[model samples]
Target chain A: MTLTTTLIAGLVLGGTYALVAMGLTLQYGIARIMNLAYGDMIITAAFAAFVVQALPSMNPLTGLAIVVPGGFIFGYLVYVFLLSPLVKRAPDKATLEVDSILTTFGLLFVIQGVLLVLFGSNYTSYTFLNVPVSIFGTTVAANRLIALVLALTIGLMFYALLTRTRWGTALRAVAVSPQSAKLVGINTDRAAAVAFAMGTALAAAGGTVISMYQTFTATGGVVFTMKALIVVIMGGVGNLLGALTAGLVLGIVETTVSTYLDPGLTLAATYTIFLAVLLWRPEGLFGRRV
Target chain B: MLTLDALSVRYGKHIALDNVHLRVDPGETVVILGANGAGKSSLLKAISGLVTPEPGVSITLDGHELAGVAPHRIPDEGIALVPEGRGIFTALTVDENLALGAYSRRARAGEARQRDFIFDLFPRLAERRKQIAGTMSGGEQQMVAIGRALMSNPRLLMLDEPSLGLAPVVVGELFDALGRIGASGVALLLVEQNVTISLELAARGYLLEVGRVVGEGSAAELKEDPAVRQAFLGLNA
Candidate 1:
């Protein structure tokens, strides 16, 4: 029964990780920028939720509704102000990637600084739909179940948009080659902006889900970002389905080890698996080896 | 009609295209022939907005200035370029590649008709619609590249070195497709190192040497020009 409960909890956690990783994947795929500040976007949304829940009968979910759109606008602004100039000035792809990493690395510190000024280093946690339900003789939190459903729904919607819609097709084209996308009449700048917005919005959603159960500080964003990076590396950068699978596997392994062995060694065990995967399949499980 | 007056491109101190002037009337096939580093590709790049031209250069297509227009807006202005190296998205399937070609709002509305027209032109594309573009042979990839450009319903199509690195039979097949494209009333601006086949396809030809148009004439005149024959066609004195 304990094993089953741990597995269920792991799955719930994995679903939210998938959401965060999906945003990272989309941003990297379209813009070819490994946005190191991705986790800050999520924490920003979480903090936004914290501020909004001060009102009577307000909840983190309500803050999510507000923050999601704000996340989109913020992401767009970031592209326009920060990323576009880098792209314009970049002499080559390798330079763009390097510059973007350095830029986002700086952005990470900026966001963390702002959050620290506003919220301090104290850990904050919020709750919503805290009801517990029984599943196959194992108890599960209703909020986590809801989170799983919501994350999976969002993932499916994203998949359909990428594979079905014209905008999605243009985004994929831009991802492959912005130059070719331009020849086909695609505004690559617009595509990149939209991709950033969508990615940040996903990060916001994942942050909201995390806010429901996890305690976070202003400096906590990097931890989440690092976890998502592990997932991305294991899944293959830009492979959405791969992210989902890798997230779940990571969650399961981490939870299983923590439950059966020492909780303190969870990260160590996780890193071991990550290193093993890196040694065996560096291109990721789903990625085509370039 | 497309007209380029005083078009120039410079990479710092090096002039890639120096004050070059050229024209392509409606439905006309024009080819620029030159050896490596002769600015033939740069001329097409300048017109396509891929490479920004220097000040005082004017490029007008049907009386609208193409100079300084955004690269993406060029297709909406009825111009499409099949860039060097086929430029097809190798990861995408053939059908997806063609679909993306019709991405502009103007082309999107007529996607069905354009797709059908392309399929009719290359039935092989229809047969291999679901295949990943990268897995295909070079000849097939080139066909996809051209078909993708056609899907935009471009008034003027530009190609850079379409014959580069293809088998003789494949080159023959590609040239046949080029003839069909010409017949469809789309104006063509081609840059080629393949002098013989290009001259046969184009109504007029320009010889570019170190970013300058050193020679210009009708196809027959260029074919008979002793200098062109000696330099490009390898004809002995």
Candidate 2:
């Protein structure tokens, strides 16, 4: 694939991946909790969306009518109930990261087990009114294009929320110093819980799209999770613009190589690029100054 | 007005602040003077709601009990603690940090009016409004910290060691700011190792040693006492 074609494909894919990877970047960036269970949690969300869509008279996209709210609720519950209790207002950036990874991985195991019991061991695809769309003469599967557009639109919306709103400003304020935040009457934990739910909803939303774009098994989520991590890592933590850039960069690279070579090796190339960039720019390609 | 009755803090086996009692009236400025381990810092922390106290002991702020009041709620109760080390948010600009202090009063009438009041108190801060707080000089950071505490529209502002490390001239400048603040009629609870200036700026003071209040009197009495002058003010200086 040429650069233009690769870019077009990459933009769509990158936008999608950015949505998925954003939660992890934020989790790692602020409190420094590593979310190793990124893939499994998302897969669980996909299955949940699948179950909703499977309802006798429901459209899968309409499942988003269920998934978005459902996603926020469940994600908020997970943060407040599960993760918030174990972590301090500001835990050690390194150790809690590993603990977060382990904890999420455990969630992955539990979710996969539940899915295996209920949905059985099988591949699934959501095919609700498949439509085709074109962008810059690029042929886009209707479902993928909508997902891509939604992912980018949401990314921008969050960017605005973070920069514009008082709540968002308080969230960043808590990010600066919990002690100072408290002095100003900002509840540090509430902000963290909100961030967790907000990030998780974005990830779950990615699950809705991924459910349609490819065949998914209860276990098919790990590779995509790793790929999303690559995008997030390259983008840098706590940086929405950087995440967007990294996601698109990964999208373009992976799409071009997968077009020319076997798609299976896309992960290998992604990991290689991830390591190289991380080695070159330890904070990330465009990480915030510490 | 503020009062602490039998206030104490224990860190496991270590007694950081043994039983201590003190009181301040409205429009009165008081300083607690001590050496490094004299619990002067802990006394301020206790008043600020940052330290745990022995139960049943009361820390009252403007007649409201504040012993166990949450840290964030302290400011709203009309007391602000400019904690030790000038706990300004390093990443925030001076203006943003100060505005956050004023946020508690946003729902109340006259918040913008209060913010403009702070800008006048610290003209240097107003001049460097866009600078990151951590990047500023020590005297400037101290001004930001004091300005931030004032932004809470506090009835009582508690300062812990505001003159930790600075030139004598800078320290003199800080005392001038405190004098202006006092003239405005806000009561201050100061913890300082610099005994002469602490007593000079304050109306009354207590001397602490090993977590206990060992000396108490009007600032004039303390300055005149031989033991206080010898132990704290260094009589010749």
Candidate 3:
């Protein structure tokens, strides 16, 4: 019974991690943006969900319809206004990486500051579908179950889109080889912008789901960012399926450690696994050596 | 027709191409023959919009000027370049690579037919449609590159050293495939160091030396020229 509970809880947490990590992977992989501000985007959407839930008839799912598109537009505008110039000026990928990291680091503070001013530094969450539901003789919160289902559905849909559609294939081509993508007549800049926007949309969706079951402070964006980054690197950067698997593994391990050992050691356990992966497989678990 | 007039490209202090003038008529096969560092790759790169030519240079496909067109847009203008080193997406499957070949709007309408044509042209690609391209041998990768370029339904197909580093037997088969592609009425602009096979494949040839076109003639005329025989064919006449 305890094992089943741990597995379910870990899966719920892992589903959210997978959801968020996919967005980061898309941004870093296709757009080539490190996106240090990614978690801030999530928190922003969470706050948006919170505000919507406080209204008379609005719900987080309804908030998703607004927040996801808003996230996409915000990301597109950011790319056009904030990042395109850097892309044009940079001579090579290495230079672009350095430039983007610095630019987004500044962007991180700007977004976090805005979030702080708007929502304050208080831990915020909303109660939604808090009823307990039984699954295989274990009871879990209905909201968390919904989040898991939504995350898996969205992630799988995204995976299908990437593998099935021509446009998605072109995006993957850009990620795989941008120069070669141009040879096939793909506008790499436009693709990057769209990819960045899609990533942001996913981040928004993840945030909306997370808001239902977890309390998130405006200043706590860094932790989400770190966790997502860890999952992305563990799965292999730019690899969608890898991100999903790595996220679940990380979630289960974290949960198992917190349950069996001490909850205080979860972060230490996370870092231990991360350091081991880095030392053993720096390219990532699924990444191939170039 | 594709026309280039006074095309010049420089890399810092070194001029890679100098006032090069050339043309490829519809459905015609033209080959550029030169030794190493003779600016062969630059000419193809210039046409494909991968490299910017000097100001006042003119590059037109049919009646449209292509001097400042973006590289990705060039495929939409009916030009496809199989660059040196076979720039196929190594991470993608053969089918996915070919599907992406028809990504340009112009090629999208005829994607199905173009894919069929590619499969017919390189039957090996049909068998390896699901296989990751990076695992293929060098010659097979070149086939994927050519098939990918053809999938764009290009009017003018440009190749830069397609036979480089391939085994002699593979080179022979590759040219045989190129010969069939030429027969299908796509104008071919080839840059090759292998003089004998290229001269046989092309109706006309241009000799580029030090980034300039030093000689131009029919294949038969150049094949018999003593200077060509000595310089390229390695025959002391």
- Candidate number of the best lDDT: 3
Off by over 4 Å in 1: A53-58
lDDT tens digits, residue span A79-197, model 3: 99999999999999999999999998899899999988988999998899999999989999999999999989989998889889999999989998888899889999999999999
Ranking the candidates on TM-score from highest down gives: 3, 1, 2
- Candidate 2 - CAPRI tier? medium
Q: In DockQ terms, which candidate is top?
A: 3
Off by over 4 Å in 2: A29-32, A53-62, A88-99, A260-264, B105-108, B127-131
Q: List per-prediction Cα lDDT, in the order shown.
A: 0.87, 0.78, 0.91
A1-290: candidate 2 lDDT, tens digit per residue: 46656677777788888888776666555545566666766787788787888898886678877886776787788777778867764346566666677888888778788888888879977785477666676666777777777778877887678656666666667766777777767767777777777777777877887786767788777776787777777876666678877887888788977988889888888889998988898677985622
Q: What is the TM-score of chain A in candidate 1?
A: 0.94
lDDT of 3 by residue, B26-74 (tens): 9999999999999999999888888888898999988899999999999
Model 1 docking grade? medium
State the lDDT at B117 in candidate 2: 72
The numbered model that scores best in TM-score is: 3
- For each candidate in turn, the TM-score is 0.95, 0.89, 0.98
Question: Considering summed lDDT, which 10 consecutive residues are worst modelled in model 3 chain B?
Answer: B114-123
Residue pairs with backbone atoms closer than 3 Å in model 2 (clashes): A34-A97, A131-A142
Model 3 CA lDDT for position A23: 92
Candidate 3 C-alpha error for residue A117, in Å: 0.9
Ranked by TM-score, the better of candidates 1 and 3 is 3
Q: lDDT: which is higher, 1 or 2?
A: 1
